[model samples]
Target: MDWPTAAVVIVIAVCISLLIIAALAVVVGGKAAKGLKEFDKPTTRHTF
Candidate 1:
């Protein structure tokens, strides 16, 4: 593809990947917090 088309494709790919990553992070964040809470029952302020 041409430079402009390639640039657009790259940008789209990066955006899509970032969105997927964000979604995954959102999904995992809850579980991670729960795990941290269990791991450190005394104080969750620092880790959570």
Candidate 2:
């Protein structure tokens, strides 16, 4: 591929990777929050 085309493809790939990572982080964080709630007595879980 040409230089400009290659650069565009790389950027698109990076953006998609970032988005997937962000989604996974959200899922994991929510699970962690729920786990932490178990340690706290009497408070609402308030999970996602």
Candidate 3:
């Protein structure tokens, strides 16, 4: 394979990895939010 082909493969691999990570983050975050909701209250102002 040439340099360009190698670069394209690397880029595609990175994109796929990022997508998988994002998906896992969403799943874990939803579970965490549900678990924490019972201990927290909503505020009129953004506190983050």
Against the hidden reference, what TM-scores do the models get?
0.66, 0.80, 0.74
lDDT of 3 by residue, 1-48 (tens): 999999999999999999999999999999999767844656523464
- Residue 22 error, candidate 3, Å: 0.4
Cα-based lDDT at residue 15, candidate 1 = 100
lDDT of each: 0.89, 0.88, 0.87
Encode model 1's per-residue lDDT on 18-39: one tens digit a residue: 9999999998998999887787
lDDT of 2 by residue, 1-48 (tens): 899999999999999999999999999999999888775645554432
Measured on C-alpha atoms, candidate 3 has an lDDT of 0.87
RMSD of each: 5.3, 5.9, 6.1
Candidate 1 to truth, TM: 0.66
- Superposed by TM-score, candidate 3 places the C-alpha of residue 41 at a distance from the truth, in angstroms, of 10
Check candidate 2 and list the clashing pairs: none
Q: Write the number of the candidate with greater lDDT, choosing between 1 and 3.
A: 1
* Predicted model with the maximum TM-score: 2
Q: Could you tell me which 10 consecutive residues in candidate 2 have the lowest summed lDDT?
A: 39-48
Off by over 4 Å in 2: 42-48
Predict model 2's lDDT versus the native: 0.88
Top candidate, metric lDDT: 1
TM-score-best of 1 and 3: 3
